[model samples]
Target: MDLYTFLYDLATGPLLWISFLTFIIGSLFRAGLYIMASRKMDKVTHEHFSLKYVFLGLVRWILPINRSVKKNPVFTILGYIFHICLIVVPIWYVGHISLWEDSRFGWTWTAIPDEWADYMTLTFLAIAVFFLLRRIFSKDIRLISTFSDYLLLVVTALPFLTGYFLSHGTLENVSFFGENMELIHMLCGELMLILIPFTKLSHFILFFFSRGATAVEFGRRGYSV
Candidate 1:
């Protein structure tokens, strides 16, 4: 098979299923492990369990002017943009939502205009660049950043860059890889899905758990008062 045909088949068939399964199973495994670890760490009775603080913790994180914002307001805003686009663009883009409906759900809803999704993708790309630069130039961040940290940024940004290229036909005039950019974009996206559970991208899962745990601890303290 030619490069384009091979890429298309690999991206849409085996890689898609492999990535989705890996994401689902790995996320469940990680969440289960967190719950088990939490049980071991705190042996409180079920009667004392309250979700009040957990809800509150989520609110705290979602709202601005908290600890994360205080640490660095600019970075916090950028983070919010990155995360918001990460969620909004995928689930709400017309093409993507249509794909979901066709593939599994058989249901479709109104999507944000393609123009807005394009703008959001640009914003996400900008944030990724800023993050990479911060990790490089900031002494404290540089000290803590592992090689995987940089790799993570690259992997996360790859799909957006390639997708933009595909949409704009930015590389179509080129001979070697231009024709295959769409498949490359799909491959990058699938790879990102598979990597999420194994890498710091697991923050998507752990963020909730960590906040919940903190809230539970706070709840216990409140009960004593």
Candidate 2:
């Protein structure tokens, strides 16, 4: 096969399946581990469990006036924007919905206009850069940052940057990476998928459990949390 066809096949075929399986299995395995570990802690803190407080605690975090959000308004706002764009662009962009329709199910949803998606993508990229710089220059964050932290930042940014270039035909205009630019962009996305459960990205999944524990503890104190 020629270059474009070969790259297309790789992106849409085997690599897609491999990456998806990795993401699914890895996520389940990590979640299982968290569940098992939480059991031991549950034994000790069983009295702390309160269904009412669990939901209340989660609601407290969702509110903008929560202590954490209040402590870092700028970070919280940018972080929420970044996450919104990150999720909306990929899932709702025309190109992506088409791909998902073809690959996963014969269903497609309305897509965000390309122009708006482009702006959102840029915003997410900018926020990602800010996060990386914060990790590097902020003393407290720097103290806790690890190599994986840096790697996560890079991996997270790669797809957004490459996708922007791909959409704008920047790579094609320069003949950058020959005809493989789209493939590279797709690979970066798949790499991110595969890393989600194994890396700090797992926090997305574990957030609920952590917040529930905190809520239980704090709710018992008779505060809004």
Output the worst ten-in-a-row residue range by lDDT, candidate 2: 171-180
Best by TM-score: 1
Q: Model 1 lDDT vs. the true structure?
A: 0.85
Q: What is the per-residue lDDT of model 1 for residues 123-171, given as tens digits with 9 covering 90 to 100?
A: 9999999999999999999999999999999998998888788778889
Give Cα-based local distance difference scores for all models: 0.85, 0.85
Cand. 2 Cα-lDDT = 0.85
lDDT of 2 by residue, 71-178 (tens): 889999898898889889888999888887886578889999999999999999999999999999999999999999999989988999999988887767566564
Return the lDDT, model 2, position 124: 94
Kindly report the root-mean-square deviation of model 2 from the true structure over all alpha carbons.
2.1
